[model samples]
Target: MTLFEAERVEKVFPGVRALDGVNLSLEPGSVHALLGENGAGKSTLIKVITGLYRPDGGRLLLDGQQVSFGSPHESASAGIGVVHQERNLIPGFTVGENILLQQLPTSRGLVDRTAIRSEAARWLAELDLELDPDLPVTELSVAQAQLVEIAKALSIESRVLLLDEPTASITPSEAERLFRVVGKLKDQGCAVLFVSHKLEEVFEICDTVTVLRDGASVLEGGPLSDLTRDEVVDLMVGRVHEALVLPPRTVDTTAEPLLELSGLSTATGHDGVDLAVRPGEIVGLYGLVGAGRSELAKALLGLDRITAGEVRVRGAAVRIRNVRDALKNHKIGYVSENRKEEGVFLEQSVGRNIAVTVWDRLRAGIGRLPVLRYVPKRAEADLVSDYVEHLGIRIASPAQLAGTLSGGNQQKVSLAKWLAAQTEILIIDEPTVGIDVRTKDAFHTLIWDLAANGLAILLITSDLPEMITLADRVVVMRDHRVRGEVVNSRDYDTMSQRVIRLIHAEPAPAA
Candidate 1:
């Protein structure tokens, strides 16, 4: 029997049919995986189920009984809980308080702190988690906070738990712990709805699978015994393009290194990292989550402090104390991993967002009009228009708000932000993350195009295929150190094995 069901669910927003006639079902005590790219309506479906948004037309049933959830609170009371990708914990509060927030055990008119701690401890112990109930949430690591969120969800005694990309930020060991937790939850007859971009994890943990594409259910029901990864990838992408998208490497191969780091060490994950990239070269950094990939990029770009070693741009030793210094002197640009928070101003117009990085070139002074007084800079505006057209950004005009664009187009705008900055060295962290197959190709094309024009790029990503396809050389990082470097040769198996070893094998200490 179905534990939950949504039939012909529809959600309309302006010109978008966010969800159209989407149908789904969940069975008790089974794990269901929701599969989709960034803007595939999976998020909308989750919101509808959790009562964050009301569907325009649909029938929702819980345990064969017709039901409507007016609020998230109502959904929670009905044993539905969601652990958002972004942890919603209050840092100042203790773990116990965060777990049972607003519902602490209390007498008629008195608080009961002891009982709350005891209960929180019990919840943690259930998952074999070692956490101090009285410890402040702020002190917890990303992995620890994730465990606390899970314990909090289980505390609700939820019948259905929605985990959206729970493993995105955590390490492999932490992910194993979560998988074990999911197993335990299953043993207790709780239904789990898992959403992840990691296909391997989904196949390993989920008993049933549902694939949603463009706000509709395309495929459902999978033990996945006979499916290959390539088959799944094909289904996800739908069609292949015949375009020779990525431009060939055009920068003089004999040129000196554009950016070089020698024994660069930071207090964070980047410890004594050393690397270099020549002009018009794309060097790909690949590793698992927490492999110090993005951290290294940030340090070289001066977004993060480096406690030791030297960073140089074109053989010149530079003191890049902040982002502004990096941009002004080194012409360094960064596309952050967390796009929503660090990449773009979602509410701002496309033109304004693109113009932000190149404001110095556009303005006559720091706060004055352009050289052509009382006249709009038609040439600069035309550059923005050309970029939008080149990237195929789907918007009515440059005046359209960045937030209103699709996930792909928003990514394009983020790229535009940096491209317009006219930076020589570009640091892109997870450029194709959360983007669809079509969009991924477009992004791949854009990155190579930039490199073809003499841009030195440090491409930091977890996606191995992307690294292999786009990089001239691949650098492997493990245990916060550079493991080895290899030239790209379109060899999947050999490359995969080497990457795995780099991630799992112990590294020798630096001399």
Candidate 2:
């Protein structure tokens, strides 16, 4: 039976027709996969279906009866739940409070704390998540917080569940757990709408597939078994996406290393780390969560204090006291994994954010005069305009807020900021997280382009395929230390096995 349907939906923004006559159907007991490129109108269609934006035309039908949702609350009340890509939780609230925010148990006109804890625990247990109900939301990791969002959605007991990029930030093991829960929900005849850029995940869990392109439904309601991955890609992109083949490195390894860490120790637990990136080289740091990949990146950027070891930039030892020092003194920059938190200033204009790193250069002044040191707005805009076009960033205008752009475009802006900084050594952590496949391809190309132009890159990622695809040398980290390094031959199986063995091997006994 058709549990829900969007009939001839049309939605438009100021200058863009986000959705044009898009149609979708959700059947009970099936997971429907929505596949598209970054700007293919997938998000807009979801928004229309969930009542975040009422369709400018057509209507939504629930159980064969046409209905309209004025707001998200109305949609939720009508058995629709959404786990958005960006986390939606109150950090000040405890896990229990976040899980049952709408309908908390009450006692004598007051909140029932014990009942709330018990109820929240029950829901979390359903998803096999082991979390303290009393812990503040801020204390949870990105993956854990995503699980809490799922638990919160499940608490609604919605017949129609919408999961957007659910596995983007999670580990393979954690993703398997989520799939098991999704299977359970399918068994219970829930209508699940799954949106993801991970084609493997879609093929693994979804029963039906729908492809959207150019704000229109290009393909609809086909059994997953009937379509090939190549077919889906072609449909979404309107052309065959040639497999990305990274060109041979032009790096001169004998040259002085642009950035090197010798006997590095950080307060966050990484110790005795030894790594180096020469000009035009790409070094991959591959590890699982808690293996200290991000912590090491932080230490490199001086976000964390380094107690031991020496950091050398361009053959000269230096102390990176903070991010400013790393950028200004050492000519090094970092692209944070947590884009929303540390990468982009969401409330600021894209031009402003991109030009921020080059403000000193943009200043038209002599020394020591505050008024004379003012930023030249025209020069900054010209610089930003070039990058916006160079990076293919899709923004209505440079004045548009960074937050208003799509995930892929926002990531491009983040990259643009570092590019504007003109830092010779760049540390990029999880650069493709939450982005689409096409955008990932673009980013990979850009990274290679940067390296080909003699900019050294240090890439930290949990994704094995990405590590193998881009890195010249993969540094395996386990238990907060470098276990070994493998040369990438572009052979996925061999490289992955070697890396996996290093990741799981027991640490050597202290010498």
Q: Among these predicted structures, which one has the highest lDDT?
A: 2
Worst 10 residues of 1 by lDDT: 366-375
Which lDDT values do the candidates have, in the order given? Answer: 0.79, 0.88
* Model 2: per-residue Cα lDDT at residue 66: 95
Model 1, 1-511: lDDT tens per residue? 9888888999987768888988888889899988776667877888899898999998789899988999878898998988875567987899999898736789776768899899999889876778889999976645567778888887888898998777765555667878998898888888899987777888899888777777877776665556665555555556433444454565566888988988888877566778889998999887765567877776776667788989889998887877777887779988877666577898888888887877666655434644544314675678789888888877768877887665567878888878888889999887775565567777898888888888999998767777888988888887678888877776888776666666777464466
* Backbone clashes, candidate 1: 0
TM-score list, all predictions: 0.81, 0.92
Q: After superposition on all CA atoms, what RMSD does each candidate show versus the true structure?
A: 4.5, 3.0
- Cα displacement (angstroms), candidate 1, residue 15, comes to 2.0
| Model 2 TM-score (2 dp) | 0.92
